[model samples]
Target chain A: MNPAPRSLTMDALQFSGTVTAAFSHDFKNTLAIIKENTGLLVDLLAMAEKGRPLDPQRLATLAERIGRQVQRADRMTAELNRFAHSADLPEAQTDLGAMLEMAVVLSARPANLKRVGLEAVTAPPLWIATFPFGLQQLLYRCIALLLDRAGSGGRIVLEADDGRPPVALRVIARTAEDRIPAGETAPTPTPEMTGLAHALQIRLDWDAAAGGWRLTWRDVET
Target chain B: MSERILIVDDETDFLEVMAERMTHRGVHVATAPSAQEALRQVEAGSFDAVILDLKMPEVDGLETLKAIKARQPEAQVILLSGQATLQDGIAAMKLGALDFLEKPADMNVLMEKIRKAQARKMLVVERRAEEKVKKIVSSRGW
Candidate 1:
């Protein structure tokens, strides 16, 4: 294989590692919350056994909290599972909206840590035959870059548009007043990201008017 | 007096449940949901030890630990995180954290660490008091 393809594979592996690590960290937090709540219940029950009165209301609340954490863990598990399978196929008929949503979900933890609000705008399904993992890596890298620029009190919106010959996806940054002023250098995508985009045949561009990055590719089918 | 400690974490649910559990074990507990709040609480009052989450939003635990140490060198801090890397653990310790514990840490193990922190803090306080007395005596030429 050429050095370019080999490097792209390494980049993909690195991206997968980062996403998996973030997901696992979140999953551990969910588990920790569940453990603490259950431990609290056990402590209360032990007290009751030793003659302290049991507060049925308190027990009910703890139970509810545990239930919610369990649901959270379940959702995280499903998402990670789906993400892992994305690499199984080199190219597949992928739902662009769903892919964007998954990217948003996986990037949520990092965005929150930076005090940035991230969300995916709802859109109708747009199908495309593409390398799922590569596309995800591209989307994630774009969002990560935007988040770095957005800083605190910033919001990022991910949108998918099926328009013209090249269906496009955008990562819009609604940041504070510190946006890059006109006449100054705009941030450029890293070499790794550029290489990944090239391998996937996606056109990645920074849209100055939109205050975000736009990724366009041809041959998107319904 | 019971051991007075502050627990700082961004997760409200974890904070609430952990505070209740610690309180039940006879520790006087206070909680902060952010690094700013934790700093405020530290400025407002003294704690035997601070249980700090390593991965808080805005100011993370290592930065907070440095700030707490600068403000009150006597304050003991224990770093806790759901995903603490080895490098983070070492950095925390080098920044004056008394100990580092991973999330879902056993209650017994946490309590033991807290107890050690309290003891170490008491020793520091006592040494400071002794130094103050010696300084006063020497200044008075007694």
Candidate 2:
């Protein structure tokens, strides 16, 4: 297998950095919660030892809270692990739905920060042979762009359509008001995104009627 | 007087636990889940220090810090972030933040900072009162 182009490699690195940073921040928050809760438990126990009445119910609730946070952290770790392995193989047969879901998961923090709702609609399995990491990177970029346009109190939906030979992925933005004005134009893909799409043999287009961006690629033999 | 402080973060669990711990330590703690609510609380009541999260939905910590300072220049703000960079710390300091601490901050360290914040706030209030008295005396010509 040949090495990826420098520009694509640079883009992927940046994307990975962003996703990793966001995940780390989330992990820190989860850890902070657990730490504080455990500290509270210790404080309560000490008070009990000093003659303060211990409420067993409160203890049970605290334990439950910690358990929930642990579960949350576990899920985040699993998602991050999956993301790390996305780059393992340069090209592989990938499931479009799963890939889109991963991209949505990676982009969740950024979207939440902007007060935008992001969801991945369930789709039937659509397999494609392409650069797995590149596909994810493109999807993330598209979702990010849509999130920006969506602004606060907006929604972004990701869905994969496998009804036809050329499988397509759509990223739709739903805002309270029309994002583009009569004289203004919709946001377009960046040069780097366009370049990546070209390299991956994916046709990227803006669908005005659907008010979304479409990425369609033909299935290729691995 | 008990130290009055407001803890602001998007994480409800964090807010609840921190509030409980600070209250147990005898500090008057109020919690806000968003910048909007934090601003409202700040306007409705006075606090010696504001514990703000650096990263939040909508308005971020830096922007909220600016707003808090604008409303009350004497307001002492301690920024907390889960993943704070050096640049973020510097920026917070430049924006009149009392201090910056990463999340999972040592309780002892945070309590010490709160004590310092309360002391500083008192000093600021006393100095302002003194300046006002001096101006009145000077204008009255003894």
Candidate 3:
């Protein structure tokens, strides 16, 4: 295969593999909870069979817990479905805020596992005609990189800044500690990250005063 | 005798439900909602076995298992994970875990493992006692 096609294929494969692995781990944890709840219910029934009175409240609570897990799994699958559909169109008018929110949800587990708080503070909803999948990849990678830099006990606040026709998004770490030192050059973006941002017509700038990197994009035809 | 087991998982529901089921089966059970809490529990009390979830928020299962073994070498640890790979199992075993079981594990199977763990723990304690007595005798030149 030619180098360009091979690179694109590899990027696609890597993105899908990572996203699927993360979602699977999340789904499995949810399933494990449901399984245990069911097991607990069964044990309760068995006890009742042996003349132990079942507490109606306890049974109700178990049922609620199972229901909650089912809903949690459903939401995760929905996010995965939306993410999969991002590649269906080459470019379209997309809600940047919603896309960023979706990326946050998709990447929340890893961030939480790192004990880093990632909160998205977006400006009023902004719609841009752009490549959705490429932007998604870029956003997810940015969050992952920030979490790695922040380590544990750190907070990262992301903002979809409203500028002129070109959109601006900021990701800032409040604390001075952590991997990305304040007032220093931005952490180097991987080749893949740079390529994704370039394809999306986005420029990355490190704002030392803001304590994070900002992504800016100029107007482009849909 | 009932086996004393500590169950650790980040999911509160899973922890509570498993603890209840194990208690119903005549095992003395304690639950920790996170690996950090599990370490605190390990430091506070000894258990015949520890049923630890592989994936947790911080201080993952393998790391937690190492800490447990360091603090209490005699503690038998059984790792439970929904996303455990072959490498993870091997690493867990190398870190002194008694067994690695996947999530949604059969309760009966787990019960059997716990019983075996309890028996093995008893043997470990007995062997340690024998070694200690032997060392004391030689040191005293008695």
Candidate 4:
């Protein structure tokens, strides 16, 4: 069997793979703590089984937390598998709704969820002709920041409108201090998001006067 | 029949919370704090889907996914992370994850994704079974 030519795909694969490697490396320590805590819960459960009275509140909390991590771990396994394999498929005629769904899912940080609201305004599923996840993550980061900054009561509105060709997604960042999380004094978009916006040919405009930020992609092929 | 969902993560607290929440949501949930334990559960149980964390001690997310797919090919996998970067998100999607959800994800969104994953599971299972049947029938009947 003949293998596909490297020139067509090697670079993108390597680039994304390296980035994910770095990302996982960043979260490794946190993951370890979670594991340790999980072990603690098991011990507590064992003690309870032995007729030992554990802190009811602590036990309940531990149980709740353990479950969350399990779910989280499950999600990561599936995500990494899907991502590593998605590189092999031709760029999907991606749907905007699905993209929006992914963006919300990716922006699932405590700050983003509590501080801001994701209002998807465009219903027409735009058929995008590019790497969907890549673009989705990029856009999600941008919206995440806005949501993070907005604090617990902040708002971010996502809308899609036709420009030169295919409809372009617009992320409106509306932030307020109340939207920011405790101990977090400010809100900022990550370099990854900015870099992605550039790569996807999307334009980002921040209005300091209006306290709003906007991202738009023009002439994106239909 | 109980709709069992497997949850794998390094954090005991997070796993417990997820199991509790899902259980409350009327889904049968299982929890594993480490990739190895998760693999054990995957080997033993016929879970409708799996929720995996990106980073964990000993067995990491990618390796665990490889193991799960190898053993339980029918299990639907979803990736979750607290420190998700643009790269990891894309990588997860590329790797065959039904979806990649960031940490502290919205409950509504998680439930919605779960539904989508479960909804697709039957179709995927039947298709695989059909393929095997076709191969068997074609060789004998044709």
Off by over 4 Å in 3: A1-8, A176-185
Weakest lDDT window of 10 consecutive positions for candidate 4 chain A: A177-186
**TM-score computed on alpha carbons, candidate 3:** 0.92
Sorting all predicted structures by lDDT, with the top scorer first, yields 2, 1, 3, 4
Stretches of candidate 2 off by over 4 Å are A1-6, A177-184, A218-222
Better of 2 and 3 by lDDT: 2
Best to worst by DockQ, what's the order?
A: 2, 1, 3, 4
Indicate which candidate wins on lDDT.
Answer: 2
- Candidate 1, residues A44-158, lDDT tens digits: the string is 9899999999998999999999999999999999999999999899999998888988888888888998998888886877888898888889888898888767779887888
List the candidate numbers ranked by TM-score, top first: 2, 1, 3, 4
Q: CA lDDT, every prediction?
A: 0.88, 0.89, 0.84, 0.65
Determine the C-alpha RMSD for candidate 3 after optimal superposition of all C-alphas.
Answer: 3.0
Worst 10 residues of 1 chain A by lDDT: A177-186
Fnat of candidate 4: 0.02
Tens-place lDDT per residue, model 4, B35-137, is 8899899888777778898777545677788788888766788988776678877877666778887765666687787777787787789999999999999
Q: Estimate the Cα RMSD of every predicted model relative to the unseen true structure.
A: 2.8, 3.5, 3.0, 19.9
Q: For model 1, what is the alpha-carbon lDDT of residue B110?
A: 93
Model 4 whole-model lDDT (C-alpha atoms): 0.65
Q: After superposition, how far is residue B16 of candidate 4 from its true place, in Å?
A: 1.0
